[model samples]
Target: MNRWKKEFSFILALLIVALLTACGSNGEETNNEQASAETEASEELTIAQINWAENIAVTNMWKVILEDKGYDVTLSLLDMGVTMEALETSELDVSLEIWLPVQDANYLETYEDTINFSESTWFDNAKVGLVVPTYLEDVNSVEDLNEHAELFDGNIVGFDSGAGTMEVTEQLIEDYNLDFELQPSSEPAMLTAIGQAIENEEPIVSPLWSPHSVFSNYDLKFLDDPQNTFGGVEKIHHATRLDFADDYPQISEWFNNWKMDDEEIGELIDYVESAEDPLDGAEKWIDENEELIGEWVK
Candidate 1:
């Protein structure tokens, strides 16, 4: 071949190679863009919790940490059964409040796959037995109540009708065949009845739990549940939907590592419950315990 023809062939070969390289890079860039779009589409998370102090306390505590991480979290309020069903169906992303041993054993046994139940943050600081003001030393056990039903005005003050503790309390009453009646009321009303009774040193029985400021403020004692209907040592279990770990691995890791000692959580519960706002307690708790919380966040 002539020199001119050879030079033209060499230039054509270089141009073809550069064109192929550019095409390959553009294809890779498109693929990357699609992958990133898929990831962004899955970023938002949903979490659910029942209407109670501890459930409210722990769920929102994690919420603050997650929001700080630039995540979009949606909170859904649900009853225990509803929360379980929602989490199982993936309608709910997580249920931060799982009370153990006493938590619906049937649900845990059945829907174990639909969600991830964190074991690390589990701690036993809540009790769901019958409770009364310390002024009533005569009532210390469930069995003891059989004899003093009249003294209690034959009434048991319970929280919202659907609450797990309330259900257990109802079962306790039925099993014991106590003449006492469990009067279901809204949380605020229940507290008002309890606070009023306490103020007067009147005898009262109510379905109660811990990390509650009321427990801290009142000199209350839990009556021995011989039946153990309300699991003697209530444990806090962090629950999340199956996608939680896959979608928000970092936040899930932090949740698994996150924990609040009894005092830390209790104080947080106090801030929210006691403030002008009946809710929004978790934010206050997070703000107050930033030092210890930083340990978990990092």
Candidate 2:
């Protein structure tokens, strides 16, 4: 009887050890599955892309960088209004081209409660105004455009009719009591008109923005808006969906630390415009500016 009791106790101990081992294995498998699911969720990112040159450049740059880091990024081309709406609905994950102080006020206000603005500026010294060739020395300010409407044929070349600059130009016209008409056209058309005017030494004024390739290509000047109708020296910013930080903390951190000066953005614009494929240019820029890129991503 003593021998039988001792054998029963030994068998019970073995059974307990086997059960503990099985539980440990199952727990590890569950933990691994959870980790894998989280990683997969973090790998996908959706970005709202505007048609502007600078937006294209920056968005493409980020797309390339993020993909290199094992992300699946999608760029959705949409107008500012649509982009803001999508962001508000959580359909869009990011936008890297939010111009502040004047250009995006209405949209910002509309979606203020639903979006997150980054803490840092991606590019600075952005400006918008009536621009003229430097040779037109007499046309020094927005007021001067009023006096020389005839030189521009009573027309101020303007960008998209829906653009914020156009809205401000209307305000400027009302404030200054100018008689010039705002000729609505595409950005490329406006640039073409400027180039033609410059070639012929004809006086031409257009609603133009800085950090543009045209600024580097042509010697032009932004008319002083003493009335502050156009807003002065705006900063380009980043905007993300409300849950971006909680969902993709790593990317949110990178965007918060991102900063690029006027020169760097202009160089990027130039490289992108010159390259046959814009992504090729972005890749080159990334390789050349690895230190700065590291700072942004780190």
Top-scoring candidate (lDDT): 2
Superposition error at 125 for model 2 (Å): 2.4
CA lDDT of 67 in candidate 2?
83
Q: Compared with the true structure, what per-residue lDDT tens digits does model 1 show for residues 149-241?
A: 888889998878766677778788888888889998877788888899988888889988776778777899988877777776767777777
Residue by residue across 204-294, what tens digits does model 2's lDDT show? 8888787788877899988888898888889888899898888787788788788888888888877777899888888888889999999
Off by over 4 Å in 1: 1-42, 276-281
Scanning candidate 2 in windows of ten residues, the lowest lDDT window is 33-42
How far out, in Å, is residue 222 in model 2? 1.0
Off by over 4 Å in 2: 1-42
TM-score of each: 0.80, 0.85
Q: lDDT of each prediction vs. the true structure?
A: 0.76, 0.83
